[model samples]
Target: MKIAFLYDAVYPYEKGGAQKRIWELARRLADDHDVHLYGMHYWDGPAVIEREGVTLHGVCEPRELYVDGRRSIPQAIAFALRVLPPLLREDFDVVDCQEFPYFPCFSGKLHELVRGSTLVITWYEVWDDYWYEYLGRKGLFGKAVERATLRLADTIVPISEYIAADLRELGRTAGLEVVENGVDFERLQEIPAADADWDVIYVGRLSEHKNVDLLLEAIATATTQLDRDLSCGIIGDGPEREQLEADAADLGVEDQVEFLGFVEADADVIGNIKATSVFVLPSIREGFPNTILEANACGVPSIVVDHAENGSTAVVEDGVTGFITEVSSEAIADRIVDCLTDDDLLADLSAGAKAFGRDHDWNVIVDELEEVYSSVVQRER
Candidate 1:
């Protein structure tokens, strides 16, 4: 099947969880089907770039509304408008839409107009007034658009069960299924054991949404309570770096925490993660964090908060695979200490984590996706 993946961002151009999922799925599905990713490019860059046997079409948009400190959405939309006509004419069987708000709000009509084409909107993270918190009053547009898109979609596949519940609350009585993104089984399993270099490690964006301050607070508590001998490694970059730096100092763990900005997706990340004993994600929201998946693949356990959205809580079996905590710094610190000190427990958790990750193999996920596609296609015909 010729699949047109409609999304906001993708790999190499962007490094978020949503994009990573598209990159991996397109590549994996490429083994049998022809997959193409279509996104609006805000920056004045190349129209086309290819990787991993998949073609990436970037519609150049004006650099306004600089989202995530990168490409502009306005230009990407205009570009999508111009480029889409030609591309959509090229005989794709189905459109796999990512980001609910965009498909319905930004590009709903396009899908609706495409007769006989199955529109599968993959809901990664739907905000519960989360965007309005940042984007202000006009964020109502996003919510309305998302609702419209959800209604128009032939199938709504939320990455987590919590998201499915949200769809029900919104009163969109559509066929909502919990079809999560999968992981790279071979690359992750191929990782060789490495020595523990950092006492603690975090590999995600340093942003407000991720709650970087709380992580620093917990680290400070761990440093003093466990003694200030251990080091903390911060991987990935974001806007909240300075605030977090201050928080680290205020907590008196400044010297112990080191922020390593934007590491490449290579063996070094795998090795660094393998060298760490504990993985952490202090986020207010997430669809299904690929970092946790990657960490689990490395046989490392995580310390994530107990938010009931998007499998953030479901990822960890709490004391089985990794520790799941309430949104508290002291609570997070205590879990870290427990995981660090107990060799038998960490070993046991690692065993459970690896097994759980195996269940999320792309082979299984793609089969489910194929089922969604088949169902959509049958209904469309």
Candidate 2:
């Protein structure tokens, strides 16, 4: 079968959960079927190139994904416009488009209408009420766009059940299939652990919704409660890095926290995770966090916050792979202390975490995606 994936950003070029998912699925599917990717050109060469047997077509020049700590509307519009012409020229069995930014999905719909291809929108998060939190009065426009995009796809593949529930609430009960995010478990096992070991680590963008500030506060409280030196490693860079660093200093945990800004290599990120005793994802909102699976693959149990918008809690088994606490610094600090203080409990969780990670390997995920694509194409026919 011929498959095409549509998204504004490409993996390795721009690191994110959705980008990684498309890259992994596309490359693996390319092993058996013809696969192509469409996105902004983050490279220096031609507009089209081949990597790992998958064809990548750069629809436009790369643009800054964000402005003033929020997603850039102009950039999204630019990609949405540029993508249609290239997409209209090709016809494939399946064209799976990412559902964020909400413009390119319309292009995919147009392509499906003109070219007679199956359109699959890989839906991530459903903002709904959170739109007001993000855009104030202008959220009405965002909400309208989201609702319209929900109807564009022949099939909608949600990354988690939380998102599926959101779609149902918005009256999109039909054609919704849940396919969760995955990790490269085999690749993680090959990378050696980093030399320095951290008592706790957090890997992801330092964005506002990530609640990383809460992580620092939790670390400070945990340090005092433990009555010993606790080292924390933060990997990744974003708008909130400076403020988070300042927060750490103000809390007097600067010495205990090391801000390792954006390690480009996956091996390095996984290596650091492997060296950590515990992983913490304090984010209040998440469609699906690939980092949680990566951390579990490295035998590091994760601590996630229990929030309505945080769909990542589904992937973590509460007492087995990790612990889920309320969205508070004190609750997070308590979980951190629980994992750090008890060696036997930590060891047990580590074993369970690895087992959990093995179950969500990228190979298994791609297999499920292949079935979804085939079913969609057959239904369209």
Candidate 3:
């Protein structure tokens, strides 16, 4: 099958969830099928390039769409519309619409333009009341657009059982299909031993939902109550950095926290997780976090808030591979203390975490995604 992956950014340029998902699927699927990746242009960048047999096309002023972290919705929409014609002319067995903002609606419109074809809209995210906590939730104007895009889609792909349930509650007709994010099996095994420097590690985008402030507060409280020199390593970067840093200072835990803004090297990421006594994600929202999977693969236990609405719900069995707590600093601190003081539990978690990751190996996870693509293509015919 000649598969076309539609998205806003991909490959060497982007490396977060959206980029990771599309790249993993395309690379894996390309083993047996032809794959093309389409990304909206932002700054008059490269017109075309091939990376590992996957063709990339960038159109639209995606770069100017945002200036100083603020965006112009009108320009973004107009740009996506402008890039549609050339994309629509392409031949594809199936078009996989990745993430939201622009990819799904834009690609869905293109799929509609092509007769006798299928558009499988993969919903890594959706808009809800809680989404007001983060930007990119479909606003009133975007809401109307989402309805049209959802209606036009041939299939709906939800990343987790929780998201599937949410879609059902909203009464969307396309039954939800579960396909999760993945972790590299061999590379995980290839990772050097975890470092022993930091007591706790947090790896992921430093966004609002991540609630790094809460983690800082918890670290401060834990340091005071535990009466131990517990240093934390925070990996990743985002808009919340300044506020989080300020909060750490205010909490008097500046010396206890280290913010390694966005560890680009895998060795750095794995090393931190390996070094830590436990991994932590105080995110208020999530969608199959790749960080947890990576940590679990490395035999690192975790302390996460159990809000399924954020995709953290099914990441693991609570109290097994990792412990899930309420979304609060106090709750997170208590869980961290438990993991720290309890040696037996930490050892058990260390083994259990690695064991849990085996089931979510990319080999198994991507096969499930392949099945979804196959089913969607078959049904469309």
Candidate 4:
């Protein structure tokens, strides 16, 4: 099969959920199929190159798509203007486009229809009310555009049931499918464990929707109540860094927290996770976090907030693999303290988390993706 992936950023150069998902699938599928990626050239290398068995076409250079740490809709419009023409001429058995930076989806859908190729829109999550949380009044318009894109695809592939439900609400249940996110167990198993240097760690983008302020407050409260300085390692960079740092200072937890901005090396990132007593992500919204799965693979348990609108709660077994607490600093702080002080509970959760990680290995996920691609192609005929 000839597969084409339309996403404007490549892995490592601009790492995020969509980039990781597309790159992983492309590289692995290239083993038995002709896989090609079309995206903006964020790297300073050749416009066309092959890596990990897949071919990549750097269509255009990335523009300033970020405004105040969030993706600006205007930038997406610019990307679509540049990406559409180059992508229209290409023909493939199937073409999958990331649902974010949504303007390109309209053109990609038209291309697929005109070429008689199977079109699949890969959605990690639906913004829903998060539009208001992130974009204020403009979010309403964003939500409308998002729904329009969701309806344009011949097939919709959401990463979680929670996202699939959102699509259903948008009247897109006919050909919707759920393909869960996964972690690389083979690489994770090779990561050597390190001594616990930090009591807690949080990795990924430090953005508004991530609710990192709540995490800082919880860390401060945990440190004060425990009568001991609780060390925390925060990995990743974003527009929220300065605000988060200010938050830690205001809460008198600056000395207790280490803001390690964006660990670029995978080994270093794995080392930080393994060296922590517990991992936590107080994100107010998520589809299916690969960070949780990665930590689970490292035999590390995590604590996540039970977001009302998203399916982050579905990822954990509540009191087994990880604690799913209410979205509050006090609740999160209590769970963190329990995990740190109670060695028996931590050990049990660690075992459960590791067991869960085995079920969502990358190999298993790739096999499922292959099946989905084949089915979609067959149905297109």
Candidate 5:
């Protein structure tokens, strides 16, 4: 079978959950099927290259579809217009499109019509009410467009039950499957653990939506209340880096926080996760953070705030894998202090997290995905 994946960003190039998902799926599928990736040239590279049985085709130039961790919808629409000519010329058995930069999927749908290929929309999560939270007044238009896309999808693959619920709420009645994200266990195990220098670590973009300020406040409060040497590693860069740095100083915990900007996933990120006592991400929204899966693979438990829309909280089994805190610094701080101070509880959670990660290996995930792809193809037949 021939499979074509449509997504703008590729992992390690643009660095996000969606990027990682597309990269992982394309490579894994390549071993068994003819796989080709249709994405923007976010990094310096040839227009076409083959690696690990997967062929990558750069449909657009670097920074053409995105800017500063945000999607320019209008540019995305223009990009779709530019992509349509070449995209319609190709034929595949199955075409999987990422839900973001949503306009391009219309072209994929046209490909399905012209070639009789199955069209599958890989939905990480739906931005329902979050449009307002993330974009203030202009979010109304964003929400409308999002719903319109959902209604047009031929098949929707949601990553979590939380996302599945959002689709049902939007009146989507069929062609949906919930496939959880997985970790690269082999890669993580290859790297030796660094010295456990960090008491807590938070990886990912330091954006407003991530609520890194809340993380800083919690780290400060936990350190003050404990009266001991407690330090955190903030790994990743974003628009909020300067403000978060100032937040640490303003809260008088400048010495306790280290902002290590954008370490490569295969290198420093894995080592850091193995070395940390706890992983924390207080984001108000998420589809299922790949970072959490990576932390668990490294035997590091996490403390993530509970957001009903964000299915990431579902991965945390409260006292078992990690604690789920309310959306407040005080609640998060209390849990951090408890985990850092209690060796027995921390050890138990770490063991549990690793066990949980083992259950969702990429091999197992791809097996399920293959089944989905075959089923979709059969339905078309």
Candidate 6:
């Protein structure tokens, strides 16, 4: 089957959970199918190139994905306009478009209508009420766009039950398939642990939704509670880095926290995760966090906050693979202390985490996605 994926940012070039998901699925599916990805050109030289058996089309020149720590509307609109022409020229069995930055889904829909291909919209999150928080009064526009996008595709794949539930509440019932995010278990197993170790680590973009500031506060509290030095490594760069660094200094945990900004290699990221005793994802909002599974695959337990919007809690087996605490610095601190001081508990959680990772391997996820594509194409035929 020939498959096409649409998103503004490409993987490895622009690091994010959704980008990684598309890259992993596209590359693996390319082994047996004709897979193509259309996105902003983060690479130089040519608009089209082949990498790892998948064809990548640079739909437009790369634009700043974020402006003032939020997704740039202009950038999304630019990609949406540029992507339509290329999409209209090609025909594929499945064209899967990421749901966020909603404009491009219309392009995929247009292509589906023109080429008679099955269009699939993969939803990471359904920002209904949250749209208000994200955009204030203007969020009504965002909400309307989201609702309209839901009806564009016959097949809508939500990455978690949390997202699926939201989609249902928003009047989407038919063709809603819950396909969870996954980890690269085999690749993680091969990478050796980094030489340096940390008491705790957080790997992801430092954005407002991520709540890295809360992690800084927790690290400070954990240091005070532990008495001895407690080191926390923050791996990943984003808009909030400077503010987060300042927050760490204000909390007097600057020495205790190290910001290792965005390690390029997947092996290095996994290696660092392996070296950590505990992985912390304090984000209050998440569709499906790929970092949790990645850490679990590295035999490191994760600590996630129990927030209604945080769908990552689904993958975590509370008290077994990891602990889920309320969305508070104090609560997170307590979990950090528990994982760091209690050697027996950490070992048990680590074992449980590895098992959890194995269960959600990317290979299994890809097989499920392949079935969805095939079923959609068959039904369309």
Cα deviation of 166 in candidate 3 (Å)?
A: 1.0
Model 3: per-residue Cα lDDT over 212-316, one tens digit each: 888998998788779986899898877788888888889888888999898777777887787888899888677778888888998988888877566776786
State the C-alpha lDDT per candidate. Answer: 0.73, 0.92, 0.75, 0.85, 0.84, 0.91
Model 4, CA-based lDDT: 0.85
Worst lDDT run of 10 residues, candidate 3, spans 129-138
Instruction: List where candidate 2 sits over 4 angstroms from the true fold.
Output: none
Poorest stretch of ten by lDDT in candidate 6? 308-317
Query: In candidate 1, what are the lDDT values of residues 1-381, reduced to their tens digit?
Result: 777787655565567777777777788777888787776563355767666777677654423424765334464566446656645555677778776436322353464476446667788776756557756896687667566667767578888776777778878666887887677767776776545478778988777768778878888788778765667888888778887888877877788888888887556677788888888887867777777877887778989998755357667778878988988889899998898888999899998888878888877888888777777777777
Per-residue CA lDDT of model 6 for 251-354, tens digit only, reads: 89898899999899988888888889999999888888999989988889999999888887887889999999999999999999999889999999999999
Best by TM-score: 2
Q: Give candidate 4 regions above 4 Å deviation.
A: 194-196
TM-score of each: 0.90, 0.99, 0.91, 0.96, 0.96, 0.98
Task: Using lDDT, rank the candidates from best to worst.
Answer: 2, 6, 4, 5, 3, 1
- Model 6 ranges with Cα > 4 A deviation: none
Clashing pairs in 3: 41-59, 41-62, 42-62, 42-63, 194-274, 195-275, 286-310
Candidate closer to the true structure by lDDT (higher is better), 1 or 5: 5
Which tens-of-lDDT digit does each residue in 178-228 have in candidate 2? 888999898899999999879999999999999999999999999989999
* Residue-level lDDT tens digits of model 4 in 80-125: 7777776777788888888998887876888787887888888887
> Model 5: per-residue lDDT, tens digit, 222-330?
8778988578999999888999999989998888899999887566788888888999989877888899998998889989998776677877889989989999999
Q: In model 1, which runs have C-alpha deviations exceeding 4 angstroms?
A: 40-52, 61-76, 100-112, 192-196, 308-310
lDDT at position 51, candidate 4:
83
The alpha-carbon RMSD values of the candidates against the true structure, listed in the order shown, are: 2.8, 0.9, 2.7, 1.6, 1.6, 1.1
Candidate 1 Cα lDDT to native: 0.73
Better of 1 and 3 by lDDT: 3
